[model samples]
Target: MKIAVIVQDGFEAFGLGVLTEVWNEPYHPEDDNPVFDFVVCTPRPGRVKGPAYDLFVDHGLEATEDADMVAVTAKRDIASPSPEVAEALRTASARGAQIFSSCSGAFILGEAGLLDGRECTTHWRYAERLQAAFPLAKVNPDVLYVDDGNILTGAGSAGGIDASLYLMRRLYGAKTAATAARRIVVPPRRDGGQQQFVRTPLGQTEADTLAPLLQWASERLDEQLSVERLAAEAHMSPRTFARRFRDETGTTPLQWLTSQRLALAEELLENSTLPVEQIATRVGFANAAAFRHHFAATRGSSPQAYRKTFSCCEEETAEQAV
Candidate 1:
């Protein structure tokens, strides 16, 4: 993939660092990770002021024209982009290139009219500002990110990582995204629908130690593991476990399990030749019918359809054989 990161004066170093970590070369984000053609550009090919330092950017906005993806790193001031930069982005988008914004970079995108009529997000603090600025845009403040097809916008701080990994998964497949995430030491995936920030108590409670239980439950997806069962295993009362789970994960136990199961199912669909029914059972669904219901609800596709699109081995399923 050819990716160009656009930066400007006052660009948030944290957001830029996160974009670099996910995309810029030498990290080997996939088996095909070596394929990234990364570039950095500014509106002008000269000194650009960051929050703490000045960077001598070598390339100009012209570089975005032929890029497969153009990422806008956040600026603390949320200023509008230069005419040259905005034009370059719109030109790239017209040619079917992906456009992404990390954190408050959505301001630039909104300025360029890309966010108009699109579902987008940014730091919760700036969500109202963004909406007020771009009246036509649908600003979803609660999500970590919003994948509006060609235009992907991330929330504040860690939201960029989530969006970047999602872009990789969308382009390269689940295994590649997972590998890149492991290298970065972040969870493999977080639903974009997940909260921008958890509203849990600031301090960790005794029952907040749910990592071991989560891992254990993930490994035992084939078995029936209810909240009570998980609570017993965690040595906590069921009520305490449920409260702690919600606090720590920002989701209920059943939602988390269903997400985990679907994630595993995605990998199996891409990497294995298992039948749909068997994969369903292995992922803790009571039966294929129930699995199909949840899969379509969450993934927007039936299991067979998902396998057909994402299967990596180039082998045909029984459905494809007909």
Candidate 2:
């Protein structure tokens, strides 16, 4: 694949590093791994001062025209992108080339009109501004990245890594992406969303206040817990507790409990040789059927399939026996 990383003055170093790690780093080349023709392109093509260092790019804006993917690295400035760079990005998009942006680079994509009506994301800090600046864009603040067809927008630093791997997975396959991830010592896939990192001081304070109650709930995922019971434990009325839970966790109490239970179920499925029925009961599901239904709905695979794919006790499964 021909990939062009568009850089500018004050470019973010970590974002570029992620691109290099995924596309440029050599690993198991003899195993028929995908090779990318990666190039760093800038508007001026000479010495450009980034946040960390002044580097020389050999190519200019025109290089993007021939690339299968044009990636815009984040800039510290987050100022309006130069017309020349914006034009190059728009041209690449018009020609069906995949367009990508890391962190604040989504602002540049916004300038190119590529994010119009598209669900996109940026760093949590910039999500509100990105939405205000590009009113037509649906800016989802709680995701690591947004893959809206040809245009992919990543959130903060690590989000760029996830976005790049996602593109690789989409273009190649999970196994191929896993090879690249393994080479870098990163998980082939990460669970949960970026909601885990959002910084809300008020939320944090509320969470701290409810910490003991939450810990108690976490330990009893096997129990069919209710909001009323949790509320009583917190010494607050049910309505007040429900509202506080949403304010603090960004999700309803039920949703949070379900997530906790599902997470435990995944752990047990991967590590234990227990039957599905037992695992379901251990994770607070009403029955094996309900567990199977929710597991498939949330994980896109049955518990048995998940175990087959990730079971640590390999010798205990039917496949291993066979």
Candidate 3:
């Protein structure tokens, strides 16, 4: 497949490097895999200046017209998307070609109207902005990437690498993607989602927020802790507690609790051999059916499938070298 990476002035060098590194290799006997045909294109097809350097590109947006995948590289200026670039992306999309954007490059896709009514994601920092700019699109700020059919959106450079490997796995096979990832020294997959990566605090007022309650709740996810119960625990009424919870966590009580439960479920699935039913009860999901429903809704995969991909031995092998 021909993969065209489109860039503009002040484009992110790391994003371009990631796409090139992942897709622009030749067949290697050691890896025993074939790579995609890759080319870098831009609006002007000349020297493209990045934040720290410049790169001369001989190809123009026309390179994307017939490419199987058009990767829009994030640029410093997402406010204005070139008409030629949008045309190239639309051309690719209209032909059923896969279109991808790394980080804020999703704004370019939004400008082209490709993200309308589709599930997508970007770095958590820009998720709100992306949604404000394109209200019709469903922006998921918590996932590392969203593979909504032909249009794919990745969070950051690391998420870009993960999504690229996932695409490789989808097109080729697990062994092929693993080989490619090994060649680059990255994990074959990162399935914990982007929730943990959101370390930025909401504001200075967070110091007075419900940190104690949240910590306590997180530790007891295996127990039934409803809003009323939590409200009494925090010495606030249910309505007041719910309001305060949203103000502090930027989500509702149920949403926050579900997210915490899902995080715990992920850990259990990755590091334990418990059956799905037992794991569900362990995570306070009421039953396996409810757990499966929420897990698939948020993580986009079944618990069993996630375990199959990320499960590992709980303890180090006795005979293995440390």
Report the number of the highest-TM-score candidate: 1
Candidate 2, residues 24-49, lDDT tens digits: the string is: 96546556668889999999989989
- Order of the predicted models by TM-score, top scorer first: 1, 2, 3
Candidate 2 local distance difference test against the native:
0.84
Among all candidates shown, the one with the greatest lDDT: 1
Point out where model 2 deviates above 4 Å.
Answer: 29-32, 200-322
Q: Give per-residue CA lDDT, model 3, range 102-148, as digits (tens).
A: 79999999999999999999888899999999999999988788898
lDDT of 2 at 38: 92
Off by over 4 Å in 3: 200-322
Off by over 4 Å in 1: 26-30, 79-84, 201-207, 234-239, 316-322
Residues 153-255, model 1: lDDT tens digits: 9999689999999888888877678778988899878888887766665565743588899989999999999999999998999999899888888889999
lDDT of each: 0.86, 0.84, 0.83
Two-way TM-score contest, 1 vs 3, winner: 1
TM-score of each: 0.87, 0.70, 0.66
**TM-score of the candidate numbered 3?**
0.66
Q: List the candidate numbers ranked by lDDT, top first.
A: 1, 2, 3
